[model samples]
Structure formats: structure tokens, C-alpha cells
Target: MDVSKPPFGDDDAHLRETTVSSQTVYQGHFLQLKRDEIALPDGGRAAREYVIHPGAVMIVAVLPDGRLVMERQYRYPVRQTMIEFPAGKLDAGEGGLACAQRELHEETGYRARRWARAGVMHPVIGYATEVIEIWFADELTLEQRHLDEGEFLDVFAASQDQLEAWMQAGQLTDAKTIVGMMWLQRWRAGHCQFDWQTVD
Candidate 1:
């Protein structure tokens, strides 16, 4: 999908997407980049570097009994196996909810009965276009799990204590996971509202 403009119904237009140029920072594992680009509406283009990433999708899958389904995976860069929510990158032109449903099935062998867009967060705003959509996935039932060939990970359904332990033990450090958890928290606490606003 095009990060050149925020998704339709994104009311916040704090930053305009100017024309850009990207340089590869790491071409292995996950794609990483450094972008030096123009700043729209400013009339003067400055060299602002960010990771030119095809933003990803994730799920906060809630089980029938209200338990959350998460995962444990070894991240080579971080050199640790962290417990994280099910997530993956978007296929070109793929909708974010589709990616979320697909990933939840692939990683945990579960499909959701109800789906809603929770919110989005830029994982690394200082240097990335990696705006990940953290969805609220509910009414889940077990399905067949089909892992991708290159993915090395484990499937785990965790309780609140278990999740807190993992976080305390230095796992669950992925930026997207943290934001997803917070998104869930805020929504449950009645602190959030999801709406789409078209860009001009």
C-alpha cells in the first residue's frame, strides 16, 4: 500500500507525505531503509531520513474465554525469543485487516468471528514509515496453522500473569507488540475511538 498518503479517513494530517528517496539500510531478514525526502507544504525540502517500510499488520486476538493469544519468536537482530502478538507484513495492495486475519491464522491456528480496526501506531517515528495497524480480533476459534517457510517461531496462548512474566523477563520488546498491547488497553478502558478520515 502507498504510505505516500495516509489511509482514507485518516483525520490527522500532521505531516504531509512529500516526494522521497530511499537507501537500503539492511536488505536481509526484514527490509530496512534510510529515506531522505522532501517535506510537503513547507515549500523547502529537507533531508529527513526514515525507514521506508511497507507498514505491517497485527492482531490482539481474544479467545472465547477472554484469554489473549500471543506468540514467542526469536528475533535475530534482538538475539532473543520474545512473546508477541500475531503479526506480519502486508502484501502489496492488501488491506490491513486481511493481513491481520491471515497472520492470526498462520501463527496461532485461529480465526476470528468478529474483527475491528483498533488503531495504528508508527513503531519508530524518528526513522521509519513502519506504521503498524493493531487490530482488535475477537470471537476466535482454532483453525489450521500454516507458517511461512522462513519463519521460525512457536505458538503460545498466554494468561495475564504469563504475559506479564514474559515482559518482566526481557521478552516482548518488539515495538509493535508494545503498541498493540497499549491499544487494547486503551480501548478496553474506554479511552479510544476508531474512525477514518479522508485526506485532501
Candidate 2:
């Protein structure tokens, strides 16, 4: 053990896992499964398997009436419908903000005039490199929605109080949406700030 170097230190001396080799075990339409041989910090080697994602974006779309646009969609893997913010995976070469705009309009039929980046998160850091960019959208206008073929979801609006209550009652369990709600609470309470921008 290196006493001078801590695991969370600035340098990589204490926590270095070098990838000796990598192989793609499976490749799907939007995800790739990879297995890698890594040299551990100690004198040992290990095999790690994970998924590769194209990244994604989540929108906390707020209406002028102090309500949020939310969605209820069935998640196949979980075999249940979940309440979540409008979100979608980024297309190849698409910017984060562009993806957010596209998903919001496609899912909720609303376009936002004002946009702000809230933050980024890794929902599956342990097994996947899926990064989701969080965005706040406001000053919205009604627009025609174009959901992807074979997609079905119910879009609705909810107040902050209602959302908080749902969360407390375990009705809201989506990780990204929970994070977005926390950001919203912080922003509303003056505990956090956002860099607002105008969408063209």
C-alpha cells in the first residue's frame, strides 16, 4: 500500500487500473457490450464487462404556470411504467443541447425559448459509461409532437408540490428525474443558479 497516495488523491498513483486489452462482446443498435482485461492496482489482473452508450440528455421543462412537463412510459426491462422527465439518447454527432431540444419537442410537443444547462450525471457508473446531460427549459410554446415510431407515452404536467409528494410516496423512482427534481428544488429556493441561454 502506498501511504503517501490516497485513493481520492489528485494523482493516479494510488488508484490505477490500466486496461490491458478490450473486446466488444456484443453490439446492438444503440449499445455495445465490452469486456476488458485490466491490470489492477496490486499485482493482479481482472476482467471487467460494461456497456457503451452514446450518452443522453434529460429536460426539466417548466411552464410559466409553475408546473413541469413530465412523461409516463413503460420501461421494458423493469416491466413497469415510470414517471420521468423528457429525455433521449444523443444521435451521432448531435450536441447535448440539440438532443435536449429534439427530445423535448418530440416527446411533449413543446419548444422552449429559454434553455439552461443544469448539470451532468452518470446513472450507471458501476457498469456503464452512460452520461446524461441535464437541462432546464422554460418559456415554452405549444408545438406538434413527432414521437418515434412504436413509441407510446403519456405526457402531463405536475406542480412542484405534487412531484415532491410523489417522490416521498415512492411514486417517482426514475434516477434522472429525481436528480432533475432536486435541481429544480434548489433553483427554486435560490440555492442554485443556472447559466440561461436563448435558443435560436
Residue pairs clashing in model 1 are: 9-196, 9-197, 9-198, 10-197, 51-127
Tens-digit per-residue lDDT, 1-200, candidate 2: 89746777577766879899999999999999999999999969999999999999999999999999999999999999999999999999999999999999999999999999988999999899999999999999988899999999999999999999999999999999999998999999998889999986
Which window of ten consecutive residues has the lowest lDDT sum in model 2? 4-13
What's model 2's TM-score?
A: 0.94
**What TM-score, over all chains together, does every model reach?**
0.74, 0.94
lDDT of 1 at 5: 75
Best by lDDT: 2
**lDDT score of residue 134 within candidate 1:** 76
Per-residue lDDT for 1-200 in model 1, tens only? Answer: 88657686666465666766645555544556565666666566777665667889888887777678888888887788877888899878989978987888888898887787877888787877788887887777787899988887888777655666666786666777777767766776788865532211
Model 1's alpha-carbon lDDT is 0.76
Give me the runs in candidate 2 sitting further than 4 Å from their true place: 1-9
